[model samples]
Target: MLQRRRLLLLLSAAGCAQRPREPSEAAAAPLPAGISCVPFARALSGIALAGDAHLWWHAAAPRYRRGTVPVPGAVLVFRRSARLPQGHLAVVVRTVGPREIRVTHANWASGSARGQVAEDQSVVDVSPRNDWSSVRVWHPASGTLGVTVFPAWGFILPPRPADPAELAARVPVAARLAAGTL
Candidate 1:
């Protein structure tokens, strides 16, 4: 009986040794399936926006902030109206990967080089050092969609916004595209 108990205790110790570590200690860790939009973006980008300025910073710049905002990069979309995506605010979320993140605000947007203001601001990237905080994103190649972030001046009429459900619905859509490749 003593020998059996010793073996059982030894097995328990070995099992405990295989336990996973905390997330904070695992920066750049490969995410589990279906993580939130932000962590998904950071892992792909290789670089994330970083700073303590009460504002946003984008690494994946999108072309427009209106319509169905594109994906898999950082960008800003602005608006001055209250129409169905006609004039609104949002941040294009994405990274080097082929996914999209769409976060918008009625009166908030910030940047690293720019200051904060209230004009339905959207588009901002958080520092990767921030552990993907403010890192906007959607899904990856799992969905057949892509977007290109661009300079604010050359805003394009964005596609329609795909509800989280619709994006997950698996409609036949394009896979990869450039900023103007629309």
Candidate 2:
């Protein structure tokens, strides 16, 4: 009886040791005040891709693979235009469907103080060609999708970590985000 109880306690302790750490400790650290979208998305994805948000698309070409589809942890890079002089960056939270995805980004809420971060917001691809070349982001302040369809450079799937299998076995995004890690 004593041996059986000892074995059971050991097993429980081992299981507890394998539990994942909270995002606040293991995930990206919180952004500093007045930081732009580029660093925010980079930190959120645990990726090292750098440069201005508008230039990430071109900069990532040699270092990371670019794609048109959004993946859960990929950074969506927006193109620079007259309205958006510097461009934008957001992390894809999930794929809502064909031509639609949910994202989390910082400093996007208009007229709100600077460096406002919105989580799990909606973005719809509106490119006429069925590609993710253009999108309309959910405007939190306006309470509606923005009338302007912003052009995107494309989605940049960040380089996978050294341990791909470990990433596959990690906790789901929703749970992490709810835990404030993502």
Candidate 3:
């Protein structure tokens, strides 16, 4: 019986190895065209940021504060270059580590449907000096970190604070009372 089981296992392994690897969804789909990351990020974040991705940092200079630190609700600004003519913008969803963050943006995935965007995608700061001057973004199509590490201008934080009334409405009076903070 043991010998029969060993033979079956070997056959199963061989069968699995013989099957061809199928193309991933990101690979099979068509490349997205005419989908700008700017408008997509604006719609997702509701920050009311305007203009091309490359110009966001410059535009935010007067209204929003810019820095290297990654914060949720801030927009990451990518520089304009030959490869990325118009540049790209992504909203920081959260910080995973000192040098790692998750962001949501459009046009990151080439084959996605119209208005289809990537959420909570990993982005790592791989700058040689650890200055957040360069980064490698996760690529869904290839299922790996992107080969091209693009240069970044920095992060832009919005000036508006969360509405006090909105926060108060979210926490029920009973719940607040239970915590003895009501």
Candidate 4:
């Protein structure tokens, strides 16, 4: 039965009438304001997705302010670039929210909210209704950390599994809670 359900989910995601579930619909909790992405990444990592040591979040950066009151399960996404404070981007891991997300960015020393055009800490309201998926079945989705960002980055990629079926089993949870289920 479990295998059948997983297979169905995979099919629904990749094919079939069931459209791919949006990333926002998979969250099972409400996000509060001031819930920065850095902390969100730190909190969501390992818990929401699989274990990831690369997604590190720090409070009070040597340059920027860390997550003062971040919630668990938020995604710390940013523009794939070299600078941190300037193009820092991320998503709030909630039970329910928007089908798609838009981001705004600026540099660190000049990233003032004066224009009232907040970038990283903007638009965290409850999501509207949509046909988006309630759960996201991802095995290992890592952020961009290529040479564009890391000057001399070098890390060994994981080996392919001998048993593809078993490897698929190692992926994250399939049945994500409905928005607000958390």
Candidate 5:
């Protein structure tokens, strides 16, 4: 009985040892099947924008703050291209550095991992100006930064105001006057 208990404990310990030790490692683990990146990013970031991921940047202009900076809870918008005709979106999980960020997104991988959510994946800014106009996403299958440089439209931040009225009220007097709303 004592030997059986010892063996059981060792087996459990071995199982635990196989678990990912860090968020990046966990990001490499395959998740269950998921929807496309648009819905996933919308739900995760609470941005509420719709349509193709490429359209999100312009669509967010009136409803949310859009910028080149990456912030937690913001949705990074990729541009439409030959490879990604509809583009892509990823919710910023954390800023790793001036040129690197960790994101949670979906549908970035191919094969069995395609359309599945990936969390804490690394994204590095590869643009020459460091403005986040282009980026290299981490490829879990290859366990490295992807070689293809994807163009990005920047990030759409969660709306600060609860309603349109509040947002209009918060707008600067100069800007509102210039736009002839004041």
Candidate 6:
């Protein structure tokens, strides 16, 4: 009986040792390349406006409805800074929560993943006011929210029949709370 118990323990230990380890984020496959955020966002969201990723905000103003409210299908525009000298752009795939969203974009990751498209990546509003003026994006390579807080110009809505009144009517209650207008 004791011999059988020992054999069972050894078998269990062997099975544990033979278990395959889960791949670390670093060990994950590299993202494919040859695309950047602007064209990807433009094609994905059909916003049409072009330039550096940062310039899309102002360039979109005259042509597209612009606001701080995030909506699915809207393009979030990152402002230019020393870290992101040319800026960045991502299409809102969906809202995850009041202050969290999933975005699809390209060129956000570094190294081999640079210029590659990333889909359904997480982005969280880190602004004190919760107005989405600043954000931290998920880093696929690191498997965590990126440490850098990037400034954002806001969202550019797709061209449609939205007038100011209709746009104003669509502002979520959370946005009104952020604006202190609620």
Best model per lDDT? 5
- Backbone clash tally (model 1): 29
Which scores greater on TM-score, model 1 or model 6? 6
Q: Where does model 5 exceed 4 Å of error?
A: 1-32, 160-182
Residue-level lDDT of model 4, residues 25-106, one tens digit each, is 3223422322222222222232222122122222212323233122322333332233332223233322223433222211
lDDT of each: 0.24, 0.61, 0.59, 0.24, 0.65, 0.63
Candidate 2: worst-modelled 10 consecutive residues by lDDT: 14-23
Question: Which runs in model 3 stand beyond 4 Å of their true positions?
Answer: 1-35, 112-115, 160-182
Lowest-scoring 10 consecutive residues by lDDT in candidate 4? 150-159
TM-score (C-alpha) between model 2 and the true structure: 0.69
* Candidate with best TM-score: 5
Cα lDDT for residue 96, candidate 6: 84
Tell me the deviation in Å of residue 72 in model 5. 0.3
How does each model score on TM-score? Answer: 0.18, 0.69, 0.66, 0.21, 0.71, 0.70
> How badly does each model clash, as a count of residue pairs?
29, 0, 0, 14, 0, 0
- Tens digit of lDDT per residue, candidate 5, span 20-64? 111244432333443467655655566776777788889888888
Alpha carbon deviation, residue 62, candidate 1 (Å): 18
Query: After superposition on all CA atoms, how large is the RMSD of candidate 3?
Result: 19.9
Q: Return whichever of 5 and 6 wins on lDDT.
A: 5
**Candidate 3 lDDT over residue span 28-133, tens digit each:** 2322323346654554444555666787788877777888888776778888776667777877767889999877565555543332445557789998877678
> How far off is residue 7 in model 6, in Å?
69
Indicate whether candidate 2 or candidate 5 has the larger TM-score.
5
Candidate 4 C-alpha error for residue 49, in Å = 16
Poorest stretch of ten by lDDT in candidate 1? 171-180
